[model samples]
Target: MKPTIIRPQGLPDSVSSPVVTPIMPSVVYASDTPDALDAQYEGRTSGYTYAREGHPNADVLARRIDALEGATGGIVTGSGMAAVTAALLGLCKAGDHVLGGDQLYGRSLRMMRDDLPRLGIETTLADPTDAASMEAALRETTRLVLIEVVSNPTLRLADLDGIAALCKARDILLVVDNTFTTPRAIKPFEQGADVVLHSVTKLLAGHSDVTLGWVAAKDPDLQRQLYDFIVTTGLTPSPFDCWLAERGLVSFDLRFDRAQRTAETLGRWLAGQAGVTRVLYPTRDDHPDRARAQALLRGTGGNMLSFEIEGGRAAANAFAAAAEGVAFAPTLGDVGTTLSHPASSSHRGLTPEARAAIGISEGFFRVSVGLEDPEALQDTFGAGLAAARGAR
Candidate 1:
């Protein structure tokens, strides 16, 4: 009358579970034959030679993410930016150029804008939501095109089909950052994506605890190259972080579903508020790219909302202070509803005019709806909106 997974042989055939993987923090592996070690070192064999190169926990997490993203292979990294940077480095040579989104996670933009150029890899920016703008930004030297599935802070949607087609026709790799939308909502690989990126710190893990990132690709050869690069650069995550992230994955859908429900309720409420300037959610009728979002994400809306108040930065700060349950987290995608101010937090490194150009105004604040009662969130966020109104 009970259902269970088939355990491997020698895994205690009784009620015991031998297949359940545990946190494996072993740094060095013991091998009897020199040939075995050499094979592992040379990538001829698929086995752990060292934790810095790969380990049990990271492998388990990577496999799960690989399956979820519909990729042939994947690898976990120390941090989200590490994953992105490492993948870019693996794909690009000294003279190669990259075309990336104008609206990205602040740190991601900064890395491409500042660091990549220093390494002789040029990066050009384009609004991925616009076909014409993206086409104009691509260069003959462009080897990769990076797109965020849902633009951070602003919640803009990317038209994946157009971008994918454009990149494919040019023999350029299309890498989709699926952190904002998560795999539960959208699988970029289905849209002709060459690879997919995730800040596993977000909805994939479904908790604010783990700091991890990963890249998944359909090509096994590319995966091997990425893994080799990871080993050479020491970009692997700790086994403990890998375990925690995988643990969070078990409940990701449940948490994301509940949070999305709350987000929808809060989005509708926020839009109707007299003092609120605008609410940005993919499902909203007023969203500029709602149709594109529907097409790419298969009608699944995300659990993120961006709103503006009348009083600019002052009001945004005051609003956070007034919220009853919503906490100000420098991060996004927490199981508990959290708030972030893009201008002062994530995108603070940019100039005022630069931030404004991306539709991030001084009054803009983003809300990552969590697994709270919709009514409670409405009350909490409503208080903040009301406070912002009073602050003006």
Candidate 2:
């Protein structure tokens, strides 16, 4: 006998129940009925009264993300920064403090350093890999402990479970940025994180086409608060973008798996190269947090890897220009591999001292391996390394 197939009720033949509706209907609201007016005007109802506040497509994506992250619920935003900003603002009060990992996305760092302070939310940066430092940094006024599963430029793995245990004892909300790992590799909530955030533009989307963000939380109250903030602040995603993200998520597992394999291969090759000084990838035995990464990550290391060149900025730029198969660009997790210099592209906004403090060297380069042939990518980097050496 064929295996039984269970389908969700009211779903069409082609689309899954968790997928967005193909056709959006136009409804005319009658102002005469008091009940209808109350349902439409009052935001208490759990329906999409307005597209900006909520939409069927957005809800579908949010539900899918929540399920993937194993969270009670989730909210989709226009951009990754929107997700980060809303998550922080929703959970933190005016006088509350936030402890963040030192190696956060450059834009996120700017938001914490410049924007949040203006709103009376103070933040302190700590090395996420160091549990003792994070524990010591936490204060009585700390409402949230923010950590990225993998640091951006350095590709260092954070000790999520250790940090979570620390935060749990202090009654602090543990917010994890799982953009680098994606849901296919690791679910932060299952690892003791209270909330998980993602920049869907990266590996989650799999193709660098659409920009979206998500916040998944275990607490129903926290999810509700995040949804309220998203709706009220008009930071919701567009229907078309939501649809694109949904399509991207369908093949996420395959893309992430292939890309991660390629990344690991490239990372190992780079580590053995003469011009490359330091290679940062969690799966590598030389990685400082290799054991911690093995404990936290479920699948391959991830698609992102970074290395420092021996000759610094000029050599790095020359190497990037000589790269063939991998495009010399800042954006990551694309169908085609892309590269960027952290000191210039993503972390350029930081002051010299600040950049140095974060360990973003002038010669450092970050590579986002894509769904390309592993050999082709390795050759491309090999050529780039040769060019860097020649330049030196």
Candidate 3:
């Protein structure tokens, strides 16, 4: 008999060879034969031909998102806006009408209201929390309805089930941005959402190192179309970033759970504070849609919360300075707790009237709670509150 094998029993097989998924940075791939290459290009075989079309790393990340979002199929893109652009332009054509929630992300609103119109696709905005408002805004040509599970900056929870039902009855495709209320909180597809979107740069990545996005469709055909659009438009994300994001996803559950706990604690403490006029957290009793949030999110308030200062923008600035250790970053979803001013960062594109209409005022402070000690965060917040009061 031959000498005993030195390697492990399963190591020889490629499938079980490595515990960590490898990062494939190849811009181009080679096949065993010409016929195999043709088959790969024609979708007759499972393989990669070029990075622009697809890559193993991206596919790995996309499949993870599919599993998380409970989607039939999915694809990764360069950025959050790229995913939005591909989904809109690929599925809806000229003369097609789209209805968007008035409280959607700032860039998304700008795209629908300003950019899509130039492409002959028109959009209408309505209060996403009210199904009646959405129904009233729909046109005969309405093909899509877009809404966020939880609105940004202010963290308002939408009536996802109601809106999904409305879209289903009308045969309109319901696309939901699940960036805020990640898969850990709720699955929109179960509520009749046809498509789900994620800004992977935020909570999904958890580290704030990668800028990426993904689109998942309940319909396989729609997913194929979106993938084709992404490939043709070169909206594919970098393979390395996809690898990094995949690593981040490994710790997503732990991060999200910790953030959720801290957010709830902070929201309650802020509400009891003197300088805070209003605190908006989905799980809070005073939240406008607390009941809805409870039902949809399973009593879990997400990590994001916003509060208003007794003073306006000036007080907000003073609070930021007093809240030491909390970085005043314009972005969100990092492992470290951070603060963002929506009026200047996420909602800067909107007019002052539009911003005020959505209640995103100068003094509003949105916090993306991170894995920090609850008492420590409260101490910083207490100092910030005192500063705000003095500033006013």
Candidate 4:
């Protein structure tokens, strides 16, 4: 059911309608009879009986995200990590095996490598930059193949369609982390992904305030199972957070479009700037996976780019400290430009060898371009470059 759209006061009751939905933080809903409440509990009825099981606010946000992904259903979790944990547990048993990309978010990699093992699931990691690495990692016991659509920090593109086709032939589920590329940028379901997950704290939420994660799937059984897991594990988000996320969706498209444009501008600018060794944005011709990125991604390669500052970590720190208008947050996808050092932040948990394998060197820094003016970004980065080149 659609949320009621209220008309504003004194506008002839026709010209204005509320563009936002009200927050529903109630933990329980009324039921006429025990039978009705039982039916709701058993998923036979439509109303929400309990917040942990299901909340009206979360349901609205889930439906919104699923609609964006062209999915059958979606669920909002307490965090993106919760979404991953719930989805994986919902799909696999104790003995099930899984495969994934080598370059993943540190926490996710740990979950697949450390936590899942303690829970009796096995996982193998390999470079997902090409189909060969993915093919080599597959096992007879593999139940799911997980990959990042674009790798963290490095911004490398995965052969999404290629891996998806392989998973189909093997009858294994394919899951893609769509955080870097939101549904507005790419629909993984259309590319053969069985499931898509996002840390809505990033692009979907737009602002840097809320912490949310969501999972979307085009399969009825998987969706039901995921919902059950969320409810049982108490990973569902609070109504207030879900409500704020729903509001964020109101301007998601515009934010994504502007961010993508700004990223492209910065990618090009960084490529020619002094003290910049290389840019790893997927849209660049020099990128090894540019062709694959073109085949899989829509619009530009997204609003993320990782560059090698000529002067190493010290220079990277100088750049961030010297840039006037930019903020150096440990996170990304905010409306304002932010910088992060993967070696110290996002990929800090990985070993030196592991980080090197993913193209994260001592000088590497990832920049998330925001909706700020292109010229302003140029000047900010220019100061950063001056620091790196020892001119400042």
Candidate 2 residues lying further than 4 Å off, grouped into runs, are 1-34, 37-46, 351-354
**Backbone atom clashes (below 3 Å) for every candidate:** 0, 0, 0, 0
Report the C-alpha lDDT of model 3 over 56-110, residue by residue, as the tens digit: 9999999898888887568899998888888788899999999999888888988
User: lDDT at 52 for candidate 4?
Assistant: 89
Residue 205, model 4, lDDT: 86
TM-score of each model, in listed order: 0.93, 0.90, 0.94, 0.92
List the pairs of residues colliding in candidate 2. none
RMSD per prediction, one decimal? 6.0, 7.1, 4.8, 5.5
Evaluate residue 111 in candidate 4 and report its C-alpha lDDT on the 0 to 100 scale. 90
- Each prediction's whole-model lDDT (CA): 0.85, 0.83, 0.89, 0.85
Model 3 pairs in collision? none
Q: Best-fitting candidate, measured by lDDT?
A: 3
TM-score ranking, high to low: 3, 1, 4, 2
Worst 10 residues of 4 by lDDT: 5-14
Residue-wise lDDT of candidate 1 within 291-338, one digit each (tens)?
888877777787898998888877887898999778888777888888
User: What is candidate 4's local distance difference test score?
Assistant: 0.85
Please give the distance, in angstroms, between residue 88's alpha carbon in candidate 4 and its true position after superposition.
1.4
